[model samples]
Target: MAGVRKRYGGKRALDGFDLTVERGTVHGVLGPNGAGKTTAVRVMTTLLRHDEGLVRVAGHDVRDRGREVRRRIGLLGQHAALDEDLGGRQNLEMFGRLHHLGARRAGVRADELLERFGLMDTGRKAVKLYSGGMRRRLDLAASLITEPEVLFLDEPTTGLDPRGRAEVWGAVRSLVGGGTTVLLTTQYLEEADQLADRISVVDSGRGVAEGTPDELKARIGGDRIDVVLHDADRLADGAHALAHAAGTHAVSTDVDRRLLSAPVADRMTALTETVRALHARGIEARDIALRRPTLDEVFLQLTAARGAGRPGATERQEMPA
Candidate 1:
């Protein structure tokens, strides 16, 4: 949407927000609290209106043609919506009926979705008895009763444990594998790192950064060579060794963690050289690895960049409306 705008009394919730998601790809929207990720999703899904700019989804404008857009998009909110007293299949069938499918077709669609989500065995089981993962799967299945073209998932995996999160991630992968375009909003950085084909980092009602996970990670700096020293007191020496090996004075040390991090050009060569130099100098290291910057680091740096000089301001420089 161009020049999209939304406000809450005196505050701008979606101030000059802009985003473009391609078809058939899972686009991740990420930000910290009060970052306007939710507001942008609301405007895009037609749940809330934007005071300015244009939003086109599936070739239909969200403002003037909301019904057409709604028909093509399926939304799964943060929490699961399943009746505890009803069976899994019953809930799916009920959603199908609500989507205007006849009774016969609804039953067939429910069974199809149950099998697709690996819930066929528990189809007759009461939803309350289903595990956290099961409930999430059922919720996702309900959203697919009509097989919408674009899916909006607002934190589809929120409070689940590792297993439940994995199950939900698998379900999302399956949907994308079937050629569904998904716009996922979540606070989990790792989830975005794994599932998103591309990610948009939003802050203060605007997209501050956007790119593939790797691309975004690369922007923070370059490959990082990390060394964990066996001796806590050797932290300073380790940082010195890393700085020398990297041919630069840029090195960071976390004394509490006994780790030193530095940017490296030739990953393996720099790592090997550092190891050799440290060994020669008798500065023993517990472990060493050459790796890219983590998503957490990239996110921190990007968000910090947004506030580098300019504090949060009410007015944002305009783009083409």
Candidate 2:
């Protein structure tokens, strides 16, 4: 969608949103709460209409070709849409039949999907008996009943444990490997960093930034040095020493963790000078390490900038579950 706009009364839900996704790749959309991530996905999937600008899906205009767009795309919403009374195979077969696959064809497709998602062992078990990961995998398989060209997964890993979330990640990677283009909106930053080849960061109903994970990290600066002080009282001193060594005053500190952090231009020189400065001040550090900026920091920095600059900005409504 280019220059898309959707309004609810006086408030614009989507304001000049733009997104470009490459085929056969996972593109991640990220934003703070009420920043229009879900609204954009709704428009692209033909679930919502925009008041202005061009919106298309699978090469067909969504405004005039909603049917064509729906035919090529599938959606797995935030909530599970499975019936606990039905077994895995029965659920998949039901979905296939609903999609207009005949009885024989639906059964065959159900069997195929069950095996593909490694649910063949539990295919006969009731969905309620399945694990969270197994049930989500079954739901994912059902969404592919028609072999759609594109799939929209909105927070697919929500409410899942670490293991369960990993299971869904593996399934998504396999689908992209088999040539499915996926547009993913997730609350977990690590999930996006793991699965997305490229990412788009949105805020205030607009596209704030777009790039690969590494590229976004680069935007916030590079190679941060974190020093965990052995003494909490030495926090201020450590921050000052590191700031002088790094040649920048943008030092951030966490008093609760007794941590002092700053960005460094030259890794080796900065590390060497930091140690010397701390030792000269007789300050003891428990640990020191150099690493790249995290996605969490990038998200906070980007969104906070936009929120601070806008006049009369208030928290927008979150998308419906």
Candidate 3:
């Protein structure tokens, strides 16, 4: 999408947004609530039209060739569209038939999908009886009944437990391995870091930042040194010592937890020097370690900065699920 703009009355859901995703990879779109992640996906999948800008999916323009775009894309939305009374295999077969695959072909396709998603053992079980992960996998399978070239997943693991999320992640990896191009929109930072080959962080209906997980993390700083002290009163001293030791005065401290954190140019050398500095100052630290910055920090810093700078902007609500 290039300079895509979608408006709803006085509100602009997508304001001059731009994104490019490579083929046969998982491209994650992440944002805080109402940042236009879902709106972007809807436009790309042909479910909603943009008032301006260019969008082409699977080599067909969404504006001029909606049918061609729809034919090449599959969408797994945030909600489940399955019939609770029907069995797993029955659900998939029904989807296949809806796509005009005949009885025999639908049955064969259903069985194939069931096996691929590791649902054959429980394919005959009613949908209501399946676990959250099982149900999501079934929903994912249903979307692929026609084997679309590009699949759009809008928070596919929302409200799922860790195990359930992991299950879906594995299934997604398998899909990408089989040459499927996936576009994922998720609020979970770790999900984006784990699953996305590259991520585009959107805010206020525009692309804020885009890169691999490591590249994004590097925006703020590099390795960090965390010093947890035994005494809360020494927090200030610890902070100063760490700033000097790390050769930077940009130290952050937590008084309640007696922790001091700062960015370091060199991991091992800075760690060694900081430890010596604390020892020389008779500061007893409970623990000290060097670690890379996390995606959580990156998300918080980037979104907070954007939110604070934008004026006359009320929080936008996402489209109804």
Best-performing candidate as measured by lDDT: 3
Question: Residue 167 deviation, candidate 1, in Å?
Answer: 0.7
Tens-digit lDDT track of model 2 for 208-307: 9999999999999999999999999999999999999989999999999999999999998999999999999999999999999999998889889788
- lDDT by residue for model 3 over 114-186, one digit each (tens)? 9999999999899999999999999999999999999999999999999999999999999999999999999
Residue 26 shift from truth in candidate 3, angstroms = 0.8
Task: Please give each candidate's TM-score.
Answer: 0.94, 0.94, 0.96
Q: What would the TM-score be for candidate 3 when compared with the true structure?
A: 0.96
Greater-TM-score candidate between 1 and 3 = 3
Q: Which residue pairs clash within candidate 1? A: none
Candidate no. 2 TM-score: 0.94
Ten consecutive residues with minimal summed lDDT in candidate 2? 309-318
The sequence of per-residue lDDT tens digits that candidate 1 reaches over residues 72-173 is 998898878889899999999899999999999999999999999999999999999999999999999999999999999988899989899999999999
Clash pairs (backbone) in predicted model 2? none
Q: Model 3: how far is 222 from its true place, Å? A: 0.9
How high is the CA lDDT of each candidate model? 0.87, 0.90, 0.91
